[model samples]
Target: MRVLVVDDERGLTGALRRGLTAEGFAVDVAHDGDTGLDLATDRDYDAIVLDVMLPRRNGYDVVTALRAAGVTTPVLMLSAKDGEHDVADGLDVGADDYLTKPFSFVVLVARIRALLRRPPQVRPAVLAAGDLVLDPAARTVTRAGVPVDLTTRELALLEYLMRHADRVVGKVELRDHVWDGPGEDGNVVEVYVGYLRRKLGRDAVVTVRGAGYRVAG
Candidate 1:
């Protein structure tokens, strides 16, 4: 996969370029957000590792512009800010993933791999199923025109399901996309589906007996 590393830190960029190249990726480096934005706009990249603070345009603005321009390539943002709101803001701006500074390079590779695994397609900014609406960029969900609050895990699960609402997703598929937990137990899928059902009404998510779960699109 081809990846872009956009950060002002030269040493970090160099290290990432070498490390990611060693891991079998064609890595490109951009020291500021303007150069990053230009390269991102012109080239095709499988994933991007963007830093929050940059010289020209900030990472948030770059990602926002990319999404506005209909760029659906997955982006993994890098930042020193580890606060909850900061993370939420990154995702709200269309980042596919976020990692705090001084993070493990191993984890970074894992995250990039995860991003590459995602299906590349243009999806609506807001996903809808019946009266339920999910704004991925805003990280908000509403049911029947009313705001519905959900825990982070619940929201992630629902987002994945809603994104694939056209079909019945299996237990293993849900676990792979939703849970970052230790085990791949299919039971976790059932528990979270139950949680979603409770919050979104019993019939909100349909159970496919011996298959999996399906949500209306």
Candidate 2:
């Protein structure tokens, strides 16, 4: 899963990025509300950690803008204020969840997991192609009811392919989604595809002549 942490506090955001990555989640950090809002609006993140106080744009404004733009990606609002009005306002402005400052990382992760439990309106929980099954919650892949252990990058690549099953996913698409934010080696996609084909088997995923890859459904 991918998460965006939007906070001006470099220390807090950095800690979140490290901690969430360690927990098997791809993370992106935004130091300000504008950058954060842009990422949240443009990308398909599993969840967002947005601080209520921000420069140029507050959390409420950011959430309102996202909702107005029809970005229903779940958001967890963070604030130092525990006042009843603040909490209510955050919820009223479209935050899916709220966390007061001095919060425990454990609790924050728990809230994120809970929000993720609710099905995404755009992305489904389980993605499958032919006999292959991927459970996002379990982070497990199975073929013909047999388990397949995948490396972190492999799992991420497979998940991306599954999401666009049967479509010709170009190298650019793969790079943007599977790898971080592009600008890496173009051959990285091909290399990772080769790795996935070796482990998941060639028949499980196919390559087009000029296009990129597809998982035959």
Candidate 3:
């Protein structure tokens, strides 16, 4: 799953990014609320970890703006304050859940999983294409009920492609989302696509010539 963590505390954000990535999540971090809001608006994220005290915009304003703009992505608001009003205000402004600072990593993970499983618009816990099954939370992939081993980058690439199954996703698009930043060469996408095709089968991912690639639906 993809997650956006918005916090100005560099240490906290860095730790969360590392921890969440290790947990098999594709994570993106934003130091301030404006950047967070922009990222949330432009991209589709499974969940967001938003800090209440942010630069330029506060967590409440950010969530309110997102809701006003019709972004229903689940948000887990974070704050150092543990007061009743603080938690209630966060929920009242459309936060799906709230967490206090100095929180346990295990608890945070649990809360995120609970949010992902919430009713009405819950996303599938496992993503599938043809006979291939990918468990995002477990970071496991199986084909025809047999396990398939993949590197971190390979798993990330496959997850992004599978999320947009059957769509012609451009290399630039893949580079932007799957990769960490613009410093990565465009050829990396092709290299990883080749790797996925080999593991999943040549017919698994289709090349659109100069366009891009598409995973069979």
Candidate 4:
């Protein structure tokens, strides 16, 4: 799963990044709210860990903007203020859950998992194409009733393709969404596509020739 962590504290963000990464999540961190807002809007994240007190924009405003822009991706607000009003405000603005600072990392992970499991208004729980099946929450993929072992990148790539099955998705589009950022080499997308084709079968993903790729609908 992919998660975005938005906090102003460097130590906290770094620790969370390392911990979440170890727990099988592709985590992106932002020191301030502006960067967080941009990333949250541009990329698809399963869940967001947002700090209530942020620079540029507060967590409440950020969540409000996300909801206004129709980004239904779940958000878990993190704050030092553990008062009745603070908690209520976060939820009222659109946060799905809230965690107080100096919080347990285990609890945070559990909350994130819970958010990911909740039904998303914008995305499906599972994606399927042809004989392939992918469960995003479970992070499992199977083709023709047989399990397929895929690396994190491979699974992310397949999920993105399957979500847009039947449509030609450009390499740049895939890189922007599936990858953290542009790779050092431009052939990264090609390399991963090759990996997917090998595992899922060549006929699973179709090349549009000079344009991009499409998964069988």
Candidate 5:
């Protein structure tokens, strides 16, 4: 899964990025709300860990703008204010979830898992093709009862293809969904597809030559 961490504290932001990355998530960081808003506006992310007290623009304004612009990716608002009204304000501004500072990483991970389970109104969780199965919530994949291991990026790409199984998923779309940023400038999609093919089997994912790729039964 990919996540954007928006916090003004450089130390905290770096810590969150490293910690989350270690926990099997592709993470991008933005130190201030302006940069955060820009990245959030420009990219496609599974979720956003937003801090309410921010420079340039506050978390409330940033999230409110996102909702206004119809960016429905889930946002988990982080704030030092643990007051009832503060929580209410965060929700009122359209944060999908909220966590206070001095919080446990375990709780944060749990909240992120919960958000991934119910990904806004966009991508759904479970996807399947024939006997092939992927459970996004569990981060698990199986083919005909045989479990398989996939790297974070591999799993993300495979999930994308599986969600659109039998249909062509172009390189740009794959990059947008899986990489969550611009200009990958490498054969990452192809390489990860190769990895998936190796783990899932040679006949699993099919490249559409001059088009894109597809996952088929």
Candidate 6:
């Protein structure tokens, strides 16, 4: 999972970066709302952690702009204002979920997991392909009921491929979405696919001859 945290509080953002990273999420931090809005607008993120009180643009305006621009990624707005209307204002502007100041990290993670599973009728929280299972919330992967430990990058790559299971995902697509962009190395995707294959099994991810890669649904 990828999360963008927009907050002016340096200490809080620092702690969030470390904690969320430990949970198998690729996290980016922006100290102010303008930067946050830019990152959210430009990148494809699984979720966003936005702060209401900000330096340039407040969280409300940022979310409003994002919705107007048609970026429908889930947002969990953070605020020190715990009043009834304050919470309403955050949701009213288009935030998927809201969290007040001094909130528990566990609850925040749970709320994010819940948000990811939105609409309930579609998009299962836990992803599976045959006997391979990936629990995004727990950041764990298992094959045939046996546990597997994957590096953060490997997990992200596997999740993206599995999310679009059975479809050919091009190298450029994986580079943009998984690596965030092109890197100096041209074969990064191939290298990581090799990493996943060693752990998951040789047949887990299939390569399309003229296209890219696919994970069986």
Best by TM-score: 5
Candidate 2 local lDDT, 126-145, one digit each (tens): 88898999886677999988
Query: Model 3, range 119-196, lDDT digits (tens) per residue?
Result: 435567788988888886687998889898998888878877887785898888787667654677769988998998
Instruction: RMSD for all candidates, in order, please.
Output: 12.0, 2.7, 2.7, 3.1, 2.3, 2.7
The candidate with the higher lDDT, 1 or 5, is 5
Cα lDDT of model 6 overall?
0.86
Worst 10 residues of 5 by lDDT: 116-125
lDDT of 5 at 168: 96
Per-model CA lDDT versus the true structure: 0.82, 0.85, 0.87, 0.86, 0.85, 0.86
| Cα-based TM-score, every candidate | 0.56, 0.83, 0.83, 0.80, 0.87, 0.84
Candidate 6 total steric clashes: 0
Output the better candidate (2/5) by TM-score. Answer: 5
- Candidate 1: where are CA atoms >4 Å away? 121-217
Per-residue error at 112 for model 3, in Å? 4.2
Tens digits of per-residue lDDT, candidate 5, 79-114, equal 999999999999998999989989999799889877
Query: Which is better, 2 or 6, measured by lDDT?
Result: 6
Say which prediction, candidate 2 or candidate 6, comes out ahead on TM-score.
Answer: 6
State the displacement of the C-alpha of residue 76, model 1, in Å, after optimal TM-score superposition. Answer: 0.4
Error of 3 at 62 (Å): 0.8
Top lDDT model: 3
For candidate 6, write residues 16-121 as lDDT tens digits: 8887766656678898888999999998888899999999999999999999999998999999999999999999999989999899998988887777777522
Mark the regions of model 4 whose C-alpha exceeds 4 Å error after superposition.
Answer: 1-3, 18-28, 38-47, 68-73, 82-84, 102-121
RMSD of 1: 12.0
Candidate 5 scores a C-alpha RMSD against the true structure in Å of 2.3
